[model samples]
Target chain A: MTQIVRTPHEGPRAASAKRPGRSAVSRRSVTLITGCVLSGMILLLALVSLFWTPYAPDDTSGGRLTGPGAGHLLGTDKLGRDLFTQLMTGSRIAVEAGLGSVLIAAVAGVTLGVLAAFAQGWLDDTLSAFLDILIAFPTLLLAMLIVAARSATLGSAVLAIGLAQSAVVARVVRILVKRVLAQDYITAARTSGTSWPRIVAGHVLPNIWPTLVVNLALQFGLAVLAEAGLSYLGLGAPPPNASWGRMLQEAQATFTTAPAGALAPGVLLVLLVIGVNLVADGLRDTLDPATGRRRS
Target chain B: MTLLDIRGLTIRTTDGHTLVDDLSLTIAGGERRGLIGESGSGKSLTTLAVLGLLPDGMTATGSIELAGTQIVGAREKHLTRVRGTDAAIVFQEPLTALDPLMRVGRQIAEPLARRRGLKGAELQRAVARALEQVRLPEPDRIARAFPHEISGGQRQRVALAMALACEPKLLIADEPTTALDVSVQADMLDLIDTLVRERDMAVLFVSHDLAVVARVTDRVLVMKDGRAVEEGDVREIVRRPREEYTAALVASARRLESALDTRRAR
Candidate 1:
């Protein structure tokens, strides 16, 4: 019996000769590297804080407004808490809430989005109506409402933010799924004797993953900013616990007396948010097909 | 005796637009029948309906039988067995027909795995043999290469290999060569014709190109307005076409060839 097969070529034969030095760098590389360094530093701080801190971030010092010195590197806050320790400890709250909220939102959104695209009748109508309702409210206000209604804890704040942001993620997923569903490969897959489960798992999911990854990264940065706003407004995870927003709240009163106390945590918060946004932008550039290999 | 039969096959979109209407055709064992028509003449739609592959929102009502088994309007699960096991289609635009992300060899192996329960070494051996039959260079390498990396001609051959993989009794080629360059189109047609003759398989070769229909088919059905207006032996239909539309199509094809001849002479 004769058999049918296709010959495969190894290592991109088309890239021969004229293509030189594949390590060409892009501006995105710089952005990505800088963002990665900032993110890694924050994560390292979180890990270290779980075990120890140089001084208690909430402890009062013997005197007021101690300038930078060996014992107090970033000086001290109004309560005489070590500025360096408070910033380091605050890393846990920022990273966890931002990462956790976006992850939850992505899971809920991607599932609903794919379902809305595939189920075109009453199911589509119902899901889309619910999505519209979610989108109608400002995400921060919705998060605030949820947090206000319940005890404002870290878990509740993250859950509220995730639920509030899910509508945007779902909308993006739905549009992408609709595009994939229209492809000829999908039509061919249906006629090729492949079952729906295999089609969705193998074909649909892989095609949508790049889009989902970029969306998740972007939403994480947004969540970080949103979490900070909540903390500043006193609706964030309540403390003796350190958060950049709660630190900012404390800084507002001491802005006139010791500016460095207000400025230190505020600078760190901006740096973290900038780092996240830069990473998201880099990921979008790299993952997008149109601009993927332009540097090379 | 006929191995596959279609009688009074009609399809209409949900918007009440008729795509294929009262179209009937048949293929006996080892027959090579061509469905020749202009675009929108329902040749492709007729085959899609028979295979239970019309897009969602389109409704098909027809009696279709394959090797003594009825298949028209069968639920998707039942149709799955029939698609690659009993009947397979080689679509137009080979680039789009095969999955872009999958390796060519693995795609050929899929039907065998799904329909016949073949796997592992047996599956690999079957895939290697299928690639060899399609005349692809370095069958092992082609199996690993993605669809986009290969040339258009190679992709069409891969599609042919896939259609022949399951040893299906009936193969449908829907404008299989419409997307290829002229020289490559001739090669693909020859490959398909050779396979149909060797396997003794019934083929529903659909195309808008009358010359292709003439070259590859033993019998021809000329469709217009979703219905077959002329059906006869390929040579008879070409030389003494009964319908006006069939005659016009043949005349236009001859004119096209003459124009090409003039351009080549220059």
Candidate 2:
């Protein structure tokens, strides 16, 4: 017998050493940290807003079109409601919409994608074609159609955005599943007497999860942006909820006198989206094995 | 008793082009048999046919009986049951054969759990034991490591461990050592040889290297163009190949061995 000797502790160190060069590693970490911090700040603001804001989000106690002062940090809206309070509440709605839509997209989209990948012959062709048609339909248009069909409520907005986003998720998942299935390990799994369901749960999912996770992160940002767009169109969360999109719409008429009303929500939305995108890029760099890190 | 009997096996594409035509072979219990040929000679397809794992758009006809269970035309459900229990296969590329994301132990334990119902401590023990059987060092550590964490030779051994974990009556190894370094290849063949004898498992060893086949197998079948050109005892065939194709294979093996010998002499 040939003796095989290896130190278990060396395994992890060796793996880390094989990662990309120092500069690349630092860059990825910086992006990841910055994204986390930015998103965390907004999430914190949203969570804190659950109990208290400077004033009630819909309270128009301050004089209409008032500028920033000790009493009104971001000034008052056209209706004299606290802009700062509205921005905080808007963060809560944005996060909720992003999370809810992504949940729907991940579950429904991954299922459809896996199905399309596994289905053979006509079924696969049909599902692929159907997804193609859905993809061709613009996301905003689809959300509008669904929102128009249903009442303009938070649930409807979430459903509309999620349904529109699922097609994109499904298409991505299909390609990923196809790539995984074509690998020799899949063939090995089949020959090992592992059933298709077991193989999917055991081998396929684990292999594709990292990539799917990065994609879902990107989708979360898009979902938030989509929800904001819908709300701007008066189809998102109804009044009193104070989503950023709706706040933007309401602030449009007062842009010249009290620009803080529009600027606060708009900046927060952009920051949230940018933070999420940066996180996705960082995740892609770390999770993908192809981008090997070189040790100095 | 014959561990595996394949008769009149014919695999053809959807367009009706024959990839493997009318090949027949058998392996008795605990026998080590080899099928040797160059690439595209249908050696791999013949083994795949036995497992009912031929790729899409290809169909196999005739009978493949594994321990008296008919495999051809069998339902996928039934074939699945027979696969890990009655026969298992190891492939050419170990890197690709094993799941990159999974720990080696989990991959080995999967068959043991599904086929033998081994669980918990027993399952871990079985996985470690399988690794030990393949002569891998530090079974526990190796088990925890991912496929990519280990060396190529170690990965191939892990693949062998998985195939042999269930202690199947028949093990089909399709060029299992072809991807390994030459120095590692000899040890791999020796390990397979020792394990097959110890477990009394019949192995259907397929390779393009004549010398490799001769080392591990007692009976050798030389194939060309999807057909078995010659079959006989290893020594007899190596010494006096009857068919022209078999003769060419034997000659090549001799020339390679001599070339290695000359380098050693220097």
Provide the TM-score of chain A alone for each candidate, in the order shown.
0.87, 0.91
TM-score of chain A of 2: 0.91
Evaluated at residue B66, the lDDT of candidate 2 is 89
What is the iRMS for every candidate structure? Answer: 5.5, 4.1
Error (Å) of candidate 2 at residue A81 is 0.6
Q: State the weakest 10-residue window (summed lDDT) of model 1 chain B.
A: B181-190
Model 2 regions lying over 4 Å from their true place: A1-24, A285-296
Q: What is the lDDT of candidate 2?
A: 0.87
Winner by TM-score: 2
lDDT of 2 by residue, B1-266 (tens): 98889999999999989998889999999899999999999999998888898888999999999899998999999988888778889999999999887888999999888888888999999998899888777889899987777788889899988888777888999999899877778788888888888788899999999899988899998889998899999999988889999999989989999999999999
Q: Fraction of native Cα contacts kept in each candidate? A: 0.29, 0.51
lDDT, candidate 1, A1-296, per-residue tens: 23332223222256233222344345667888888887777888888988898887668862567877888887888778887788887888888889889988988998888888888789899999999899888766876788778877777778878987888899888998888777777766666677877888777776777777777877887788788788888777788778888888888887887777778777777777778777777776665433444434
Q: What is the C-alpha local distance difference test score of candidate 1?
A: 0.80
